[model samples]
Target chain A: MLNELRKIQKKHGYVSEDSIKKLSKKTGIPVSIIYGVTTFYAKLHTKPTGKYIIEICDSPSCYLNGSLDIIKYLERKLDIKSGQTTQDKKFSLFIDSCIGCCDEAPAMLINGKPYTKLTKEKIDKILKKCKS
Target chain B: MQILRKTDQKAYAKAKKLGPKGVVKILKDKGLTGRGGASFPTGLKWEMVLKEKEKEKYIICNADEGEPGTFKDKFILVNNPELVIEGILIAAYTIKATRAYIYLRGEYEYLENKIRNVIKKVKAKTKSKANIELIVGQGAYICGDETAIIASIEGKRGQPRKKPPFPTVHGLYGKPTIINNLETFANVPLAILFDDWDSKLTLFSLSGDVTKPGVYELPVGTNLRKLVELGKPKHKVKAVYFGCFGGCMPYSNINLTNENVCGKDCMLGAHTIIVVDEKHSIVDMATNVAKFYEFESCGKCTPCREGTMRILNILENISLLEARKRDLETLQELAEVVKETSLCGLGQTATQHLLNALKFFRKEFEEKCR
Candidate 1:
């Protein structure tokens, strides 16, 4: 069911009520239960997000190594806060737990691709690359 | 370094010759333990599943390495996947499990293809009977727990359930199951094939305020100072946290072995060493960790959910200089209750860092208090 939901979210940018209903009808799992499962997980969402989701690690190792500074820079550059999507829906930002790249510190995953050892300039280049 | 000192498929071939009981004896003689923080005896755990009368059994390789400071599992998976796969095959054969799953964390979605390729190759090369599959996690830290991982696999909310009808007796789909960390399984072939391999060698993920931050495979009883030096601290190391679950210890003479650290009133949980310099405030670190637990708590138990929330609030207040004199005592009392009353390890160890901070660095918290 999670794999199916992920597939739907991959296509639609997020799991919608219609998708949940369709999944329920197909799998015989009640819509309410599927909705509950959707909200229970951090990856699954009920709302639409931007094209690229930026999940930055703020766990102890990353935070101590200045992940907050990276987060602040990304927030300023995108003109949005953590957990917010941009007006054009090009990007969404979130505070992730540990993506297990603590060795690099100041790390994040942009659309599931890891961007490690981040600096403001690196973030700029990444954003520019995303835009291009 | 080979994670298990050897990663050849010869171990699987050897295990086939020795059979289940013989392989269990090798693991027992080596005294291998789980590497995913719990340190439960690996041989005993396997033996439990072996003793079960149920014929249908399942094996799960827990790759949900979500603990705040731990990344060694990722290193092992990426660097020594063949060993992990061979270990998995050996385990499946030992317990007579026909199905096996690798519950890889979702953040590692990039490695999915790499792991799948390795699985296909290893299974084909071994001509194994177990049907191995990889199931990626959907972002829940609690799913790292055994029961919770089972629940998530069953397509339910990833919440932990009561144990003692343990996973060994009654597990996935009401059948006997054996779930072990990927690293724990990686050690199995070492126990089976290598006669002189030391079971004490363990991986430590060292990060935070260090010049060289990465994973190091060292003996279990390696000194804390030596482990930190491997990372090359830039400033006077003030404290070290053992993967956020073991609580923190002020810079003092300590060792990294489970028993040695446990004797010093800290846990070497998952063997993750986060070296903190004197420049950082303990209050800030505690609040940061508190917030992590609050966010990750599954909300099944009130003590854990509410306790972590309130613990975070208290730590944040302390960090912001808005805490009262009694708030310090309140924090300790709250931590004690949360530690004693919580159902799962998440809640039980939630306030460990703060409690340790208050014990070793009370002055820092008091200075911040109004």
Candidate 2:
């Protein structure tokens, strides 16, 4: 099962359906259970997950700090909504709850690194360099 | 996925062994209180979990520290994951449980990943004889409560239930379970590493009116006066809004000091302290906090569901042109009910901030209510 997971990893990318299913088998938790869990939870995904799943905080503070317009700029640049997959399949946008970095409001995740106090121009610059 | 020793806190030592018995001893020595908003006795909580007679026991570290003005758990979990990890290990050992789980907030995906990575590293380096699972809660405030946390971890939506057959007796898979806050667990590593001497390490995040608005680690007896003095740039700190959710104190406490302050002395939360700066409107701050509880109320029980919405209505009235002196009295009455007679701790304790803010700054509340 481990070998099959490795082969699947080699064939696909970082995350795979078989690997998630294998985790289900190893844990004695049903395959569908794992599938449901992966899908139900916003963080987990069955398919290959991007290295950077940028989640822009759309909470009130971020909204006050102009996160919606920032999201629009991101959508135009990446050509996708907040939770949709991109064409390049490199970046995926996650509509996040309050990131709690309200002091540095208008925060977003870049490769799991939280970047706060963002502007449209700054976001564009970050996107140019952000991989996934 | 390696352990990050990069903590701003004064965390230097590592506890090689702090099994259940050692924890009891430390609890006795430090007179350590629970860090989960409630300053209840840690020893008593331990006794509750230990008294339970169940073969399949569980230990859960509550990393869902989601109080709006609080980020103490995030700091510890992100910068110093081992502190909580060591604590979780000790809890599991004490409860005689082979399975330990850390339940974090869904919105805190970044922090959750931080913990998950550390768990992986810990598993790889040390042979985890006990099976510890890292679980993320799907965005619910009530999950901060032990019962809801248990439900969420068991692959179910997080919601509160009756608690006479408390979590210690029947939790997670109909087994005895122990759940504690992140700061509580972080303290465990200190209990293990340090001599059983009484000392407290604090992480106070100074925001709003203060000069520095970051998490600061200090010692036990530091006065709030000195702490505020340190936070000042040039202007005097007019007020303070320390702790989160459940407990709140005066603005003068933050103004009073620049030295270290411990748990039992002041109104700081389990591991967080916030100072409201001069420029930010305290009225606006209080109203925003009131609205936060109103928005996050899980609507499980009557006292919380309707009460919080009514509070929101009053707050919106204050924001608009309909607030009255009677509204303040009604808000206070509702706060008492929500604090005392709610289904879970969220509603029961959610009113603490609003009440504290209003009580401390009644003039501000009165003025806002117009």
Candidate 3:
């Protein structure tokens, strides 16, 4: 069921109500059940996200190592808060749990790829490349 | 690291030669425990499942390494996929399982293809009956719990279930199942091949307040000081947080083991050694941990959902210097209640670090309160 939801997400960038209804029709599963699974997970998106999704580690290890600074920098640079997407729909920023990169500390993921040991300059370079 | 790096099928070959009973004996003799923080004796766990009457047994490799500061399982999977595959095969063959699943985390989505390739290669190379499948998690940390992982795979909300009929007897669609941490499975081959592999060495995830932070392979009884020193601290170390399962321990010459750390009311869980330098505040660290639980709580049980939010509220007030004197007592009472009444490990250990901080560093928290 999750894999099917992921397939729809990959194609549509988000799981729409229509998509959920269609999936429920095809799978013979209840729409409420499908919605429950979709919303239960942290990764699944109910609303449309930008082209690129940005997630910074907000757990203890990263917080101790200056992830807050990196988060502030991204918010300022993207002109959006933690859960908001940019006006251009180019990026969406979120403060998520640890992504298993504690050794590198202060890490973020862009479109499912990890960017470790982040600094303001490093984030600048990453976002600049994302824009291009 | 050396033990985890070897990809030889010597252990599998040895297991095949010795057969099921002989293999369990070898694991028992090695004194190997589960590396996934539960510390259950691996041999005994396998023996229980093997003795079950159910014919349709299943094996699960718990690759969902979601603990905040722990990544050794990811290290094992990325560095030596073959070892993990061989370990899974060993478990399947031992218990006569017809199928197996590797629940990899979605955050580590990039590793899916790499792992799938390795699985394909391993199955092709071995004439095994167990059909192995890799399922990526949908970003729920509670799924790291064995029961929760099963629920998620069954297309549910990934909430942990009550455990009396443990996974060994009843799990994964109600048949007898054996779910082992990816690291625990990785250790299976080593235990079969080497006589003393369990006590010789293990991987430690070292990070925070250090110049050189990475996974370090050290001896079983290695002291916390040695592990912290390997990270090369830039400032004097004040305390060490063990994965968040184990609370913060003041910097001392304590061995990084359940026996050693347990004496100090801390657990050496998953060997996640996070060094806290002198510059950081205990209240701030505790608040950060509280916030993590608040975001990750599944809200299934009232205590966990409400308790985590309440703990965060109190910790936030403490951090902001607005906490009343009575708040400390209330926080202590709440921690004990949540620890006792909560449904699963997430809520049970949620307040552990906060309690630990209060225990060892009460002065810091009191100064913030009236």
1 versus 2: better TM-score goes to: 1
The best candidate by TM-score is 1
Ranking of predictions according to DockQ: 1, 3, 2
Model 1: per-residue lDDT, tens digit, B1-370? Answer: 7473555589999999999999888898889998888888988988999999987899999999999888888898788888899999999999989699899999998999999999899988889978898888888999999999999888899999888899988988778888999889888887788877788888889999998999998998888888888899999999998877889988777766778778766788788889899999888899889888989999999999998899888888877788997899988999999999999888888888888889999999889888
Model 3 chain B: weakest 10-residue lDDT segment is B1-10
- Model number with the top lDDT: 1
Q: Cα lDDT for residue B80, model 2?
A: 75
lDDT of 2 by residue, B1-370 (tens): 1122322222222322545556666666676667675666676677677777777888898887665545667777767786677667666667778699877775566675567677776555544456777765654556677787776677654667887787778887988777788877777656545554344555655444444555666664567677666656335555555544634455444332322222313344544445554554556655656666676676668888898888878877877757888888888898898889988767876777777767666887677655
> All candidates' TM-scores?
0.98, 0.72, 0.97
Candidate 3 error regions (>4 Å)? B195-198
Instruction: State the RMSD for candidate 1.
Output: 1.2
Clashing pairs in 3: none
- DockQ of model 1 vs. true complex: 0.86
Instruction: Write model 3 residue lDDT over B1-370, tens digit each, in one string.
Output: 5655574677888899989988888888887788888788888999999999998999888999998888888888788888899889999999999799999998898899999898887766666667898888878889999999999888888999998889999999998898998988888888788754645578899888898988898987898888888889999999888877678878998777678888888887788888899999988999888888988899999898999999999999987889898999999999889888899999989888888888998988999998
Model 1 earns a TM-score of 0.98
TM-score of 3: 0.97
